[model samples]
Target: MADRPVPVKDLKLLDIKLGQLPGWLASRNYSPMGFVNGYRRGYNRFYSKYIDVKKGGIGGIAMLLTGYVLISYIWNYDHIKHERWRRYH
Candidate 1:
């Protein structure tokens, strides 16, 4: 199961946008549907150009795992530092 390839349409990689709410709303002329569709169009374009079902899933999983480890390490370091500070102070 782990080696099974995912369908391209099901892989939602980097499909999110941030800080574009204001611009997207303005571009839509205050229409929610237009703004949402514009994002969908962009995401579709990105997926079509860069993402392949055969390759994307494995890469995405690897990236996610790497990111998780990195985040965990940083969070643990911060918590350890905080605990040491509290213990001594």
Candidate 2:
């Protein structure tokens, strides 16, 4: 890999573009629900590709539900154990 000298003009242009990011994001209306909706849309799109409704919708729902249950259990297991131990002690 070789380092190339960037022209001052190009550097200044890049700086100006980067500086506009915050203002651009602020100008657009974004909400927490919007973010959630976007995530759900993306997840559904990706999941749909691997899931076949013709075979059965239950299979897809079951997979997603089981994944959610396992992840939630693993994530909270430590906290739950801590609370239980505290109560016992």
Candidate 3:
């Protein structure tokens, strides 16, 4: 016979220490400005590493343009389909 599963409450792994709460929260970058700053920092790093002309070259530019064009096409796909249908009918 298979062993039965144990209930989560019976496990000691889920225990939390109240004393660690403040320190944990303080260590995290949780504020709105902090989020924006973190995002900008990450984006800058990515741009420099992959999207910038010096490091990434033509391939990166091509990928960026292709992505933009793909997104634009998807965004206007419904409109383009409607226009084609209107013209045909």
Best candidate, TM-score-wise? 3
Best-to-worst TM-score order: 3, 2, 1
* Clash tally, candidates in order: 0, 0, 0
TM-score of each: 0.31, 0.38, 0.47
Q: How well does model 2 score by local distance difference test?
A: 0.67
Candidate 2 per-residue lDDT over residues 1-89, each given as its tens digit: 89996543334224546766565455433689878876887687757765755565566778788999999999999998988777543
lDDT of 3 by residue, 1-89 (tens): 99896543333333435665555456656899989987897678667877765545677668778989999999999999998877543
Task: Report the Cα lDDT for candidate 1.
Answer: 0.61
Give me candidate 3's TM-score against the actual structure: 0.47
Residue clash pairs of candidate 3: none
Per-residue error for 34 in candidate 1, Å, reads 1.4
Instruction: Assess each prediction's global lDDT (C-alpha) against the native.
Output: 0.61, 0.67, 0.70
Query: Ten residues in a row with the worst lDDT in model 2?
Result: 7-16
The regions of model 3 sitting more than 4 angstroms off are 1-35, 51-56
* 2 against 3, candidate with superior lDDT: 3
Which ten contiguous residues of candidate 3 have the minimum total lDDT?
7-16
